[model samples]
Target: MIDKTTQPALQRLRLNLRQLEVFLATARGGSTRAAADRVARSQSAASTALAELEAALGCELFDRIGRRLQLNENGRALLPRAQAIVDQAFEAQDLFLGEHAATLRVGASFTIGEYLLPGLVSRWTQLHPRSLIQLRIGNTSEVLDAVAAMDVDIGFVEGSQTHPDLVMQSWGHDEIVVIAAPGHALAQQCATPQQLSQATWVVREHGSGTRQVTDEWLLGHLEQVRIGFELGSNEAIKRVVAASDGLGCLSRHAVEQSIADGHLIELATHLPKARRKLAIVLHREKKLGRGASDFLAHCRAAAAF
Candidate 1:
């Protein structure tokens, strides 16, 4: 093993934020040329910075395969640390700037992020112009992880998961509706499980809150439903369902515009109401900062719950 403590001070001096930034860019971009472009530096400068970082650490962080670079174990290990450092540096800077400059990091699952959050964010910004909101959009699982890890100050999710590490509060309820193209066989009639199962269906991917709810409530009755497509985005699913003979179970909010425009028709189902609660999630032990508290209040008032 190498003696890290005896390393020369010159080596320590060379491992600066610039080198870390270059390392991160290279890791993410997967090419020195792309990293150089990302960092607004010449290719040579980026390469030099990466080299300095690796040499100072006395290890190879990446495997140079022809034109592409892949992160090795060391690089992967360093990535989160480097990101934490950069984020903390920004936070420290904000501390000096003032509380109003502090940012509220928000994570939202697809439906809320794409449809609902934009209006809420706009309203919040109008009320507190000085506050900054950093938004991340992903599936329900990703939003929960962000909240658990404290990467986001708050999260909005539609999934039915309750985590011990999170404090979950009901934000509102949303209805899931069955929809199809106007010409679909079941478009004008109430859909029976047997009739629905025979039709091709376009649905969201597995990790989505909408998909989870659909699986429990719809597919639970129609076990052998014909799945035509598993789409990643709600918009894509809507478009596919609107253009094809496929049926889709989606949030009413997601399909409202399509139904209004005659692209899609909401089908009546034989089952009970498909309603689910939308929730606001946060780390259990996390103290509410001013920005987070204000945003939470806004969400509660907007939801009227």
Candidate 2:
């Protein structure tokens, strides 16, 4: 060997995957304990890793706000780059293990999660049998937040809501139908707008995409709407409307089975058809890995069919 000791020393790497992992988890979870749980480390270890990372970068990444760790300017600036590096590392690992060994994280709104994605996920799982998918279900706004925060790889939601940090792609469309219990007075007749406005309604909570569309569609046609109840779950709304005289406006996929089973009736109304755009959302800065890319392609193909 040539004189190894006399050669210039290679600069050591100051940052590491562990430190970045802790940083990312802390940024998302807002606490070292949460970060530790996410990364399967002790809280003390996570805190040390975060501290070491800040020291290496010569800047504090997060602001200490009581018990929470909020991303300061430095953290925000590093997030996308860190995410890309970590994701590429995972992708590299999967390359050696095979495509089916990859994992995907998905966030979906209530309607899509409960009604739409099950069949699609089932089909996808059949094709990629060794793949793992973690699906988080939330309302549209929550899904948007998850995608923006880098907590999920991709999100599917209903509504036209836009986020500055996200790219939204039109995935498909869904029809919103007004339904009533079979015994409700409006169930058997073509209800006039005035009659429909006078009826009590059971609807989704305010943050829900279905609720947003319902307000726009109903308020556009009727002078005013009478509120009866606001529930979170689609199944709960369906049951409440089926058991009471309250009307409900929900996605067709959410209520079609109930209507077929005679638990609910589609109201014959004079109002125009209501449709909402379904969209796929992702962080604008995110570089999707093979698993996410493949799933997105699958969604596009499914939508086309």
Q: Please give, for residues 1-305, the per-residue lDDT of candidate 2 as tens digits.
A: 75776454434568999999999999999999999999999999999999999999999999999999999989988998899899998888888887758679999999999988888899999999888999999999999999999999999999999999999999999999999999998777899999998999999998899999999999999989999999998999999998899999999999989999999999999999999999999998999988899988987898741
- TM-score of every candidate relative to the true structure: 0.70, 0.95
User: Candidate 2, after superposition: displacement of residue 106 in Å?
Assistant: 0.3
Whole-model lDDT values for every prediction: 0.84, 0.92
lDDT of 1 at 207: 84
Task: Give the clash count for each candidate.
Answer: 0, 0
- Model 1: per-residue Cα lDDT at residue 70: 94
TM-score of 2: 0.95
| Top-TM-score structure, candidate number | 2
